[model samples]
Target: MSVKPASSNRPLSPFMIGPYYRAQLTSMLSITHRLTGLALAFGTVFLAAWVTAAAAGPDAFAVFADLANSIVGKLLLVAYTWAMLYHLCNGIRHLFWDTGRGFEMKTAYASGYAVIGASVVLTAAVWAFALLV
Candidate 1:
């Protein structure tokens, strides 16, 4: 005799994301934290290339300098700066979590928003200082 498989009305894992549960602020922030981490890794490579160019020769350094002074390069610099600040702020939040704090729903959401705000403000301050000096 053959046995029939059981059937259920439950949604699969992939379908649960949209229909069963909505994305929360905490979850979104967590995802952003991970992406910024990847961005930081790539940014480190760019920084290394710049340093290597400087050590190579004037011609090599000039190539990097020119790129750095260009519009696209400046935008990339701004993005990297933001990523650094965001990662740092989010990391501090994670530290608090590790200490068993900020676990409440309200506190978690507030901290997530604070991290984003602090990163943006710090990025602007750093860029402004760089431009002024």
Candidate 2:
């Protein structure tokens, strides 16, 4: 005789199941840090292409420059800038954790927020400087 397994009632996707399923700052920061790392990896391909274009000569470099100066490219640059800043700040937070520090819940949460705040402030400051100069 074949028997079916009994199922207990529980959400397979905790995120969608309840209003109280809100993500904690630490978890969100962890996911964001990993995502930003991946984004930087992908952005590196563009960086390599730009360098190759420069080596190829003025015409190729000009094409690369024009594309980078376009609106979509500007948006990608902004995203890459933010990702770099976020990854840098989060990496420092991870370093502190590596030293066996900031394990307290309050400290961890505060550091997570600090990383996010620093990334936004630094990214905006860089863009502002770029635009004004």
Candidate 3:
């Protein structure tokens, strides 16, 4: 008796889709949450450097102060601020989820959007207050 070989069927053309193809709000928020967490780490490093410089005396503090006043530095500061705010809001969302809340699809989406909106608003308000003070 002869045994038949197994058949092999493969697609003629296999195209790769984008990583975020048709991603839902929750998925997008999940990615953003991780990214912001990383960003906050870098931001903390910068903060630590600033504090260390301040402690090192006038000359060292002057260097950091000058950089902080530069245009690029200002933009980075803003971006870091937003990252912090976004991470904070998303963290609260996750906390709620941990408590067995916002598991529903609609509620999850709503909270995702709300987190984004609240982050923007909080960042803007804090910046405005900083500028005005």
Candidate 4:
């Protein structure tokens, strides 16, 4: 039985998408940076609302703070902290590259891996501190 290739000479636009996994670390990191940026944006809105409620009155503020200190809130805080720190550190790495430095292939990969490692380490540390305090 003769069958043509699955894609069959069709153009590969995102509009005609199929399973594709270009699992390169750099691409993964770039995508992750954008996702984390979105998380941070949502977190910021949550925080702003908390602050606004707090300024409204003691009762309103306590309610907001209580919810924020709940188990779910604590879990979210952990994730949010990591997202914030990771994005910040990665932004700094990019800023360095923007200054016409660290463009070497080895340096690029080294910095990318370093960003990943540091993000994990910092996330763990922040969660540990949250647990202790």
Q: TM-scores of all models?
A: 0.85, 0.83, 0.84, 0.79
lDDT of 3 by residue, 58-84 (tens): 999999999998999999989999999
> Model 1, range 1-133, lDDT digits (tens) per residue?
7766565555554466666679888888887898999999989999999999999999999999999999999999999999999999999999999999899989999999999899999999999999998
lDDT of 2 at 90: 96
lDDT of 1 at 111: 94
lDDT, candidate 4, 1-94, per-residue tens: 8899888898654432235654667767877899999999888899898889978999999988898899998888888888998998899999
Q: At residue 96, what lDDT does model 1 achieve?
A: 91
Write the residue-wise lDDT of candidate 2 on 1-133 in tens digits.
Answer: 8665565455564355237656778877887888899999998999999999999999999999999999999999999999999999999999989999999999998998899899999999999999998
Clash numbers, per candidate: 0, 0, 0, 0
User: lDDT of candidate 3 vs native?
Assistant: 0.87
* Residue 40 displacement (Å), model 1: 0.9
Worst 10 residues of 3 by lDDT: 11-20
In order of lDDT, best first, we have: 1, 2, 3, 4
Off by over 4 Å in 2: 1-22
Which numbered prediction scores highest in TM-score against the true structure?
Answer: 1
Model 3 stretches with alpha carbons more than 4 Å out: 1-21
